[model samples]
Target: QSYIFYGPTMSPFTAYLIIRGISTLEIRIRQQEKNALKVAQFLENHPKVERVYFPGLDSHPQRDLVKKQMHGTGSVLSFVIKGGYAAGETMVNNVELVTLAVSLGCVESLIEHPASMTHSELSPEERKKSGINDSLIRLSVGLEDAEDIIDDLKRAFEKV
Candidate 1:
């Protein structure tokens, strides 16, 4: 026997549910964007960070395009650690306030080493070709206080 599957369609109830959160979601997302930019700036200046990739930063190659297309930069940012995978692991493992997790867009802050965690199955060459180096770390800034988050990163860097 063969089976076919169909996804649920958007009904009035679903639309109502989505509309209910729009206003609050918009406010929280704007705050997250601001916090993310601040964190990115801090990481860019840190000695342990080799580079940061966030469109909100002037260093991003597509910053001009980001300014044209979006009112605010999104909350996600990635950076390369100076000491490679081992340092990335130490930082993620040591973070107390920022949860070490693979997912994104949560209410609490999260940090992860994409090379050793998310993309571990791939070989080093494959990961390198994909622009995911052994030292690369991905962060999803959430609704947490910006200073607290930055402090969490600073503490974690001490471990590295």
Candidate 2:
């Protein structure tokens, strides 16, 4: 037996256009990866950051595997703040260049505190089981200058 279902507004033309835009998309992705790695490194050395999770970092346990399998590490990273949940909230609120939004893979930087924003519905035990702690702050590095992004994070950390 064979089965097929159609969505309410699937657009073949839009899909075709997106397929044709792969080259430009790849260039943006490369730049994002570079900027993300830079920001991750910056955070790793920051006094207020307890830990950084980025596949591109040497400290990541799977870094070798990631480098072997992927063209480049993606543009997202997560770090735990020293002050836990309150510090995470403060950093997200104070960031000017990095918007405090849940969505990712955009042209502008985005940040969110998953414990309070994305996965708030989950109980503390559930969130911890999923490796999301109260201090975790997710950052989606965008197509901005690496230094500018780092500067934004620095200012936010100061407020924290």
Candidate 3:
């Protein structure tokens, strides 16, 4: 019973194209999740990584629950650095491919430190309780080839 109430400027072909792309969002997410799990696995074994946290990892505390309830891992994951806050900052600044930015769920990868970026305004005690530590680096994997993504990350570690 829903009617298509588009403007005269909107061509039927263009409208249908937009609708088709929107409808594939779920499919796109599944593919991205699969790609992300592969990247997470690579990072986990990398010598520079102190810890990798992805819901797909069996070592992750919520892995089973996430697998049961979620269709995908949602493309974003966080990890802690061995040297803590300073090391995280070094990696963020040294990375060439991945951008440093807030927000997620995009077609391009992004990295950010919540304690100094998004949650910078929070009080020290609030940040601690929330587990948004200065040493944490959050990555939102994108459509790029996973090898290239991991290579860029490894390059960043060289500078850190």
Off-target runs (Cα >4 Å) in candidate 1 are 1-20
Report the Cα lDDT for candidate 3. 0.83
lDDT tens digits, residue span 1-160, model 2: 9977665774899888888777599899999999999999999999999999999999999988998898899998999999977888888999999899999779789999998899999998999999999999999999999999999999998899
Tens-digit lDDT track of model 1 for 3-104:
777877799998998898785898989999999999999999999999999999999999999999989898999999999889988889999999999998
Q: Is candidate 1 or candidate 2 better by TM-score?
A: 1
Off by over 4 Å in 3: 1-17
Q: Give the TM-score of each candidate.
A: 0.87, 0.87, 0.82
lDDT of each: 0.92, 0.92, 0.83
Ranking by TM-score: 1, 2, 3
* Shift in Å, residue 77, candidate 2: 0.7
Error of 1 at 158 (Å): 0.3
Q: What 10-residue stretch in candidate 2 is worst by lDDT?
A: 2-11
Question: Against the true structure, whose TM-score is highest?
Answer: 1
List the candidate 2 regions with Cα displacement exceeding 4 Å.
Answer: 1-20
Clashing pairs in 3: none
